[model samples]
Target: MVREKFTHIYARAADRKGGEAELESLLATPLSAQELKGISDDRWLSAFTQKVFQSGMSWKVVRNKWPNFEEVFFGFDIEKMLLMPTEMWERKATDPAIIRHLGKVMTIPENARMIHDAALDHCSFSAMVADWPAEDITGLWRYLKAHGKRLGGNTGPYTLRIMGKDTFILSHDVEAYLRNIGVIDGGRDTRKSLQATQQAFSEWQQESGRPLCQISQIIAFSQGDNRL
Candidate 1:
């Protein structure tokens, strides 16, 4: 039997998705803080670059060429990436080995610089991210957007989650659910809307003790015509 209280969101999602077990299986777990802190800086830079390239492109295509990207980028070594000359970048752009978008290729150096700077300041970039409170994940989003190139919108959130940070992406379904429930209004990226969405998620977390990732997923599953 489902309780009809604050946890109705969980109940509704479970009901629509077959049962609680099914819903649990559908949710992805975020990496723990200590595990996240253990990830190397180069891997972080590599993941960020991958997501940037995949943003508006075919994920399959990008994935197929990822090995070349690693080779060309010198395994995403922070110091080596910083030392890569502008002319080398141009040559790499012309290489058939990887996706040759100059603008996107150019973004890598800037993001690497940002990550390297964080590493210098906080002992390691992963440490800084691991230390950040999940309750204000949006602050981390804003900081990354202001500091890193091409990291605004879903890019930063997506990369953070991929790197094991416990954050949420405002996927279309999640945005639609937020709006339909009046937790948000107008543009999903607006400050007012994000604040409202954050508050709602925080309240839900308090009640259910679920990670923000799962809560975000549940909110999306509980709404629209997703019943199955």
Candidate 2:
């Protein structure tokens, strides 16, 4: 009886539609490593990379200023960054091309030193990527937050999870949809709600002989109504 009830609820929740759009709307536009490498000097890349990290603001603003940031920060070259003194930080802080946050401006050099040290120890950022752990969500979480990454705390974890990179199972949207379908108790604790969904999803996958990817398709199809 409970099985029939859950299957019906799942069918209803899955009918919402436009899951892809919902996924697209939530992603942040961060630059890839390959794009970051095009700059002439690593110093500019270093400074700009850190600048983007400091960008708690809109990604579009950061994306637009990427070239300017490279120009202003000596192409993020680590040596140049290490050479920079307090005067250089003050100069960049006043520049309109970059974020201009004093704290972020100052963090560039320090971050450069850290990156440099890491490079020496780990053989550049590329090497670390090459040696990355499992593609499973939990492994991705450990990798991202590994080695003092400080990945923006909970929101960062949530973002990575939604993008299918890390330990999180249920997304905020999925949880909301579950509530909309009246599967788990809406007023219950979130942890409990999430656990219940995970269990139900697991069982459904087993019974339906569907992988998570196929399940994602079902989610997208069912939730089509969630478009912008």
Candidate 3:
């Protein structure tokens, strides 16, 4: 369960699937702090809302209607969304362009306010996310779950990944790998399991000098699945 073991597993998988270069191509490079900081708050809000609504629904449906969502939500303008009246969102529940789920529709403004508040406190929502230590990304996940509406479990982590942050996702294959590595006993999403996963990644980062995203992808790929 050391760094070398993980590397060996990745090497074998890469060899089996057309070699190291191909495996590298499958991994996403994380954005730099400066690049992340430059992203607008509206875009951040949009990404958060997309991930929120995509939860427990077909991603294809969300993807197909994203343009409509953007249109109706005013491009997810944080200030404008913050000012949206309750009745306005209620009316949107029956709109055909976007998903008509009332609870998900309602979360848009609430999450927009959360983004706005983060911007108010830190000058920009991107800055707050960029400032979080990548080595302790689980802490950032915890922060989002506590402060942002409907950003619990994988939602926060998935949002951060889509935003190009240097974080690990506990996907099915990744969880299986973690358990196989003795990082967790039951694959439960508990604080202890998260801490163990974090510590293991920190160790692997030190040993391999790779970003968490790539490391996570390698672990997932090592499980014989192409899904990232």
Ranking by TM-score: 1, 3, 2
**Model 2, span 1-228: residue lDDT tens:** 113343453464444433445543433343344543332335423533543454477867777777887788777778888898898789888898777777666666765665566568656643433244323323433444453233333433443332332132344555455666665676433445545655655655556554443443345344545433
The all-Cα superposition gives candidate 3 an RMSD in Å to the true structure of 1.9
Enumerate clash totals for all models, in the order shown.
0, 24, 0
Q: What is the C-alpha RMSD of each candidate to the true structure, in Å?
A: 2.7, 7.6, 1.9
Tens digits of lDDT, candidate 3, 187-207: 456889888889988988887
* Candidate maximizing lDDT: 1
Determine which window of 10 residues in candidate 2 has minimal summed lDDT: 160-169
Which model, 2 or 3, shows the larger TM-score?
A: 3
lDDT of candidate 2 at residue 129, scale 0 to 100:
35
Cα RMSD, model 2: 7.6
Q: State the displacement of the C-alpha of residue 88, model 1, in Å, after optimal TM-score superposition.
A: 1.1
Give the TM-score of each candidate.
Answer: 0.94, 0.51, 0.94
* Span of 10 residues, lowest total lDDT, candidate 1: 1-10
Candidate-wise lDDT, in order: 0.87, 0.51, 0.85
TM-score of structure candidate 3: 0.94
